[model samples]
Structure formats: structure tokens, C-alpha cells
Target: MMADDIISSFPDEILCHILSFLPTKHVVATSVLSKRWKFLWRSLPFFDFHYDGDLFDYDRNNEAYSHFLHSVDSFLLSRDRDEPLHRFRLRSDSTYGHPVSIQRWITPAVSGSVRHLDLCLDWGFVMPSVVFSCKTLVVLKLTFIRVENTFSVDLPLLKILHLNNISSPEGLDLSQLLSGCPNLEDLEVKGFISTTKGKFITLPKLVRASILEDLLPLEVVKDVEVLFLDSKYQQILDFDFQNLVRLELILQLSKDWLGVLEVLEHCPKLQTLLICIYKSSFDTFLAGHEEVVWSYPQSVPACISSHLKTCSLKYYSGSIDEIQFASYIMGNAKYLRIMKICIDSESHFTFGEKLHMERELSSCMKSSDTCTLSFEYSS
Candidate 1:
């Protein structure tokens, strides 16, 4: 069959499914394709409109956006509650005169049947309260967006929440938000660096969390594998996670060694542990200083995980304190099968540092003859 024939022969449901992935502008434009496609856009439950101003023509941007939402609202308003939104995404760089205009345009369709809502507006104003606590929403991604005050959202069915650069200055208690979302599964919290006071997002049911906030994320996500973000030292609350298996701790700065060691003491069954220590913040200092003042842990915690088998440490420096920490871990990791250390090549450590590091290697070999330690150095 010819291409046109195949396209024309497709079912209405199939056509709607295909149109769901396109932008609202393109979906609305399909009305002029043929009489059959005139009403095909309305049946499309999925609406994805990600507009980047650089690519699209600037002159007609506002007009194009206005028509798109009007069409979506008119279509949804014509439908019933039994027909809820399957997915709705609004990611744009379009600078509307007022931020509420964007909310005013899209609020109706969101009420219809949106299962997923992903909103990211950089230069826009605050979003309406209805967007935060949508009932039918199962997955929500909010970035550079602030929720309105004087309202409490109850997202009883929200399963996944990914928030970045979000803040509530007007006493927007985060514990209340998490209290409502009992079924939350995956949480990714990233905070604004310029924030003066600490911000917290509490979740009781988060199974997996990716934390990039300055403040320690203390939650009761028990029996789940935890992956920590890059930090020099962080003091976090302890949870009873006896069944924990995997852990990824990224240490880039040398702020508080004592706190981090304390955290390691609790993970009893952390089989696979990846430690990434970055040098971006200390590059200039490393060159000027003769001996690096590593924030040595005053005392190593008594907690040791006999089940830890695999470990990876990045940004490994051949320093006395570094070796000491390594020695302690290597000696204690009785069941360790493989250990990998990532070293920088440009680093010309002083003679004393090299000797200290060698002592750690010898001690490790003597203690655990069966353990395997491999060093990956980059020159």
C-alpha cells in the first residue's frame, strides 16, 4: 500500500496515540490535515508541550501558546470525569507577561485526567496551588517552581516526586506535603546553593532518594539501598535498615570526616559501596600547600559491615590521612573481594605522602591475603 493509504487506513485510537507525543501546536495544526483529523486531537489523552524559545519563531510564540491551551481546555471541558488525563507536560522558556497566565490557561485540562505532571519554568512566576496536590497525579516533577500559600495539597496517590530548586518562604511546611503522599517511591531532592537557612523535604515512604542539598536528608527510608550525593561531610539521622545491600557515597570536600565515618558504621550489609571524592574545590589549594590538612576523623566508629564485599573510592590521594582511612577500611573489610581506588595523574604528592600510602598498601596485603585491591590512577 502507498504511504498515504497506510496513514489514512490507521484506526482513530492509533492516530490519537501517535498525536499524543507531539507538541500541542503540532497537535492543533493536525486539524487542517483532513476532516478525519479535525477532531482527532481532542481524543488524545497525552499532551506534551515543551517549548524552547530559541528554536521557535519569537513573533508568533504567544499566539501559538494561547491557541494551544484554549484548544486543550475546550477539548477536555467537553469530556467527562471518567475520562481523566493520561499525561500532561508543560516545560517552556516562553516569558509570558505574568506567570498566572500560563496557569490560567492550563488549569482546566490538568483537572480533567492528568496522571503525570512535569513543570519547569525558570523565568516564570509561582504556579497555582491546584498543580501541586493533583488527585489523579501519580508522577510529578517540579523545578524552579513555587507553590502558593494558604492551601494544603493532598496527593494520596502520588508515587514519584522529583523536585529541584523549589522553596516555600511563607512557612510552607514540607513535612505536611510528604505526610499526604504516603505512596511516594522515588525522590530526588536538589536545593538552591544560595539558600541562607537549610531546607528540608521529609518523606516517610521514599524507597530511593538522590540528595543534593547542603543540609543532611534524614528520613526513615528503611531496608532500601541509599545513594548519597557529593559532600565533604554530612551528619544524617540513622534508620534501622538491616536488609540494605548497595551504597554510593560521594565525598568531594574534606569538611567533617567524623560524621561520614559515623554514617558508614551503621550500614551493616552494604555489599557494593562506591565512594567518589572530587577535587574540584581543592585543586588550587592542593598545588599551593606542602601538606594537605585532611580533616582526620577523631575516632573511627565501632560499626563495621562484615558483609561488604565490593568498594570503589574515587579521587584517591596518596596522603597520610587518606592511607590511614584506607588501611582502616581494608583491615576491617574481612569479606571484601574487590577494592578499586581512583587516583589523579597530575598529582605530584610529596615523598612523605607516597611513603604513608605505601604503608597502607603493605598493611592491607598482610592483613587480608585473599582480598584484591586495584588502583586506577590517571596521569
Candidate 2:
């Protein structure tokens, strides 16, 4: 007899590749397509499981929640033990669930030599330690999770790592985690951190790093080439960033412009600079003194005079302080090639006001004769 379906004739590897694009639940549902497909999902190299609990309350719909848990558990248990997982992602938006279930679900994938792992949940829970020492893990992202430095982390091949709102116990230093990621090249960290003083690790391969708030010590990230800082911790910028090339800063409207100039003074080799100013609730209380008065520095920063090539100002309000700050950079940056001014929609500048603002900044005596200035508004 002829084959019932030509698709079933495809090798298991090919069929699994086609099914990998579908959701984990959908992949399991495909078993009814044919007897040959019954065990096909077991050999899949990746799994993506997502549960959006915002649709219903878990307390009132225990049956649905239980069914979700059971379904996930059964699918994982039935997966081929010898098959290596290329990637695994589990995201739960539920405000409540069994934390132990997370550990149980991840253990098998870690043991299966998963290369990439991503876990995002609405609540915090301690992560399984087995994930820390996974030899095959290359990328790891954790959000709303607690990581304990209770065990040694030896991710020799890990290149990218993101830790968002990761809570750890007091004196649990981050150096313990960085020391193990010897080959890590890119890292992003958010939230606050608590650690004992004098504990710092240097990653010779790290070239890119993004930090939000007071998440880590400056000493650990000083050698990065491309750095992004989004916090009010101006003290962190007090250090010399000798290797920094591209820098981005998110500052509040109430912050001192002098502080930003002070930062530029330290990055001697910086070539690109982006500054974004955001309004804060504290601006209301400091209304009279909210605007920063820009003063021309006695000596130009080394970066502005030599290495700086591009500068951008975002959320530009048509305030005198903003105009002065833009003009100061335009006047001093000898090698600046591009200067972008992005207006804030909330400013509601009239056509004439915008033209006037443009004219004022365009007339500045720029040291770089080839510099191009452009203005933009939110679309």
C-alpha cells in the first residue's frame, strides 16, 4: 500500500524542525495528526511555554491552573531524555504558582544540555543551582528571580547574560558570578545589589555592559567599550572610564548639567555620546530651581576636543538651559560630525518657537566646521 501521507515520510529530525516554530502546547496537540507524529514532539530541540494568568484568577479557576501544570509536567516527562535541548524558555505571568514546579520543569532541560535558557515570572523565586554550572549554556536571562551564590558558577562558554531584578541575600557578591563567566562579552544588570566591599572581578572579554540603577560597583565594568548607564547614581560616573568608546546616559531633568560634563571629562577615548533627559516627580517640588544653568568650562574635555565624533540630545525641551547645553557642546567638540536634537512632544512648541530654537542653536560658533546639526520631533 502507498504511504498515507508524504509528510510522515520525512525524517524525525526534519519533522521536529518544522514543529519547533509552534508553541509547546500546539506541538503536543499535533500528535493526533498521525501515529508517526505521536512521539515526534519528544525529539524537538526547543520548547517555549507561556501562561498568561492575567486572563483569570487562579483562586477561582484552580482546575484550569492545575490542568496547565499537569500538561507541562506530562510533556516534559515524555520528552526524549537523550535529546539535547538547543533552547528553552518559560514565562509565567501568574501572580501565584508552585515555585517547586519551576525547579522540576527546568531540571530536565538543564540535564539535557540546554544551550540557551530564559525564564520570566511575575513573582520571585530561588533558581535551581544546576542551571549555574550548565556546561552548554551560552545565553541566560532571568527576570524576577533570586540567584544565590551558594554554589560555584562555571559557565565557560556563556557569552551573554541578563539579570533583571535579581535579588540575592546580604553579602552575596556578584563577583562570584562574574568570576565564572570568563568568556562573557555582553552583560545587562538591573535592580539593586548588596555585597561586601573589596570584592571585584575583571572579565577581559567583556566589551558591552548596560547597568540600571545602583546594581553593581563601577570597578567591575570599567573596561567595557560600549556602556549604558540609566540611574541617578552620578557618583558611579566619578571613576575614569579609559576604555569606554560609546556611552549613553539617561538623566532626570532636575539633574545638574555640570555632572554630565564631568563624566565627559573622564572618558578620554569616547567617540559617540547619547543623553536622554526624563522628567521626574521631584521636579514639581523643585520647580523654581529645576532648570540647570549651563556654564562654559575653563578647559574643554579631552574627548570633546579630540576623539568625540557624534553627540545626540533626546527629549529636548525648549528651555534656556537645554539650548545653552546644546550650544556648549557644539562650540567645543572640534571633531563632532553629527549632533541630533530630538524634541519632547510635551513641550508643545509653536512653529515660530521651533524655528527660533533651531536658529539659535544653528548660529553657535562650532569648532568643527564639518559638523551637521539636525532637529527632530516625535512622530
TM-score for each of the candidates:
0.68, 0.82
For model 1, give the 10-residue run with minimal summed lDDT: 192-201
- Compared with the true structure, the alpha-carbon lDDT of candidate 1 equals 0.65
Candidate 2 Cα RMSD (Å): 4.2
> Which residue runs of candidate 1 sit more than 4 Å off their true CA positions?
1-41, 53-83, 94-98, 192-204, 214-219, 229-239, 255-258, 280-283, 291-305, 314-379
Please give, for residues 1-379, the per-residue lDDT of candidate 1 as tens digits: 9776688679988887777777876887888877877766666677676655544676687777666556645655553345556787877676643466567655875576678888887635676777666788888888887666625667878988887787665745455566668788886767632232324445556667666765343544554566555554344555645545776677655633455566666766677777766656565566546654455454443334367677777778765556656766677777777777777766777768756665567656423446787876765
Top-TM-score structure, candidate number: 2
Residue 235: error of model 2 in Å?
A: 4.3
Reference-based lDDT, each prediction:
0.65, 0.81
Q: Which ten residues in a row have the lowest lDDT in candidate 2?
A: 191-200
Model 2 TM-score is 0.82
